[model samples]
Target: MGEPVARIMVVDDNEMNIRVLEALLSGRGYTVSTAHDGEEALEKIQEEIPDLMLLDAMMPRVDGFAVLKKLKENPKTRLIPVVMLTALSDLDSNVKAVELGADDFLTKPFNKALLLARVRSLLHVKFLLDELESVDEIIAMTARIVEAKDEYTEGHVERVTAFALGLGQAAGLNEWSMRNLRRGALLHDLGKIAVPDDVLNKPGKLDKEEWDHILRHPEVGASILKGLKSLASVVDIVLHHHEKLDGSGYPDGLKGDEITIESRIMAIADIYDALTTKRSYKEGMSKETALRILQEEGQEGKLDERLVNIFSQLVERGEFESLGDRIPNLFNIPPPPPR
Candidate 1:
């Protein structure tokens, strides 16, 4: 198929500036959206995310820097390529814009050819990133299908995703890390598809043979997508989520700090959901009880103390539930098919 016509947004307070950018982009058959100020740009962005953005460096109230900062901070809008258009040619201005996550910077009265070239370059990069996200979506759908093989763990993937993201955000994880965390949470159990139903759903503790089958999932899941460079962060979380700080847990005996923050966060989320979720043979535990257990695990060095502490505070303050409601489930994995 031919490349999809890219959607471009131009955010500038000046009507004249907006018109020039709109005319230029629309003339090239690109879909264009415009906002007069940072606040308007942000609001419009929520309505429809553009593939690329052209942002003015200065404006009233909400300036370009503020808008750039906001966009870069959000995982949803963070990946949209942004070009900073400014009148200031000073080195500091350029540095500040780059620091704020501007994909490209151009001084005003910019050469039309140069601007279009940069726009094309960034758009190409964005297209590649979108393909990666598309791959992630396919895997997420596969993970949901895997989840469907068991009746006892309804909504497990979604719950783990929400909890992991809450912990990630509470721990001040940046936009990129948060994105990978969500992907890892959903696909963390993709390897479970390899386990037999009888073994997966057994009511009692497993025999050594059954237990060994369960242990291969992390590596299996990791290997499934190890080829995707974009998902490298995700692979780490999937592969090491079961590993412990003290080298007791897992397919690999990864020691402390050997595991990444995203992996650590996934491990905590996975354990918490398993503890609190109802199963065929056991009722779900209370939130209070679950929190206490997590805390004990944290104190024992099984989990990251800072993250566990943060998660406990979020759960206790009633902040945790809303996280599930507010977090965007990108890729929009489809529901299970009819029986």
Candidate 2:
């Protein structure tokens, strides 16, 4: 396919600024749109997502800072790169914009070449981000498909991701790590795609052969995700999530310190989601019952005690309840700790 045209949204209260930027962008083969202020920009965002947003720092009603805050808060529009265009070239404004997630900044007495260069650079970054987001959406959609196919796991993938990210944060993982934790949770069961439908959908307990087939999913998923470099980290999580702290887990029976923190966090999130979410073979266990299970696993050295304890705290405080509501397929309650 030919290089796609980027959609650019110019948000500025100054009529002259909007016209100048709009013409500049349209001339560069970009699809241009305009909003006079932050409020109008928000309205336009709901109608169409732009590849890049050029926002004026000062505007009546809703300012650029307010708009940036709202955009960063939303998952849907957060990935779109924002460039702050304003006469304010002071250090304070620059720092504030960067902190609020503006991808670039430009002074009002702008240089045409510099503006074009910055726009092109930001657009390229946005293209990479879009590609990455598409891959993540595909992985998430695949997980949902698998959950739909397995009658017992309507919301399993989403819940696990919520729990995993919470645990990741509680363990002092950075924002990037927390995001990676969610990716791991989403792809944790991808290998199950290779399992036979009969085996996957069976309502009864798994026999030896079925168990064997189930155990292969980690490796199968790893292989599948490894083929896509974009999902390399997720592949490790899929392959090693089952490994326990005491060497009791399968697929390699990795034990204790051998497991990565990412894998350990995924293990707890996966098991907790599995227990609280209903399956064809069994109804969802109560919240209390799930927490007990996690605690027991921690005590038995199957899971990281510190992470499990933090997860349990989050459950006790109802932090996870809201997440369960946002994501489908899991029980509508917080995950319980391993007994």
Highest lDDT, which number?
1
Per-prediction TM-score: 0.73, 0.75
For candidate 2, give the lDDT.
0.83
User: Residues 104-200, candidate 2, lDDT per residue (tens digit)?
Assistant: 8888789989988998988887787666656666766787777676666766777777788778888898655555667778778888888998898
lDDT of each: 0.86, 0.83
The lowest-lDDT stretch of 10 consecutive residues in candidate 2 is 330-339
Write model 1 residue lDDT over 197-223, tens digit each, in one string.
999989899999998889999999899
Going through the candidates in order, what is the number of backbone clashes in each? 0, 19
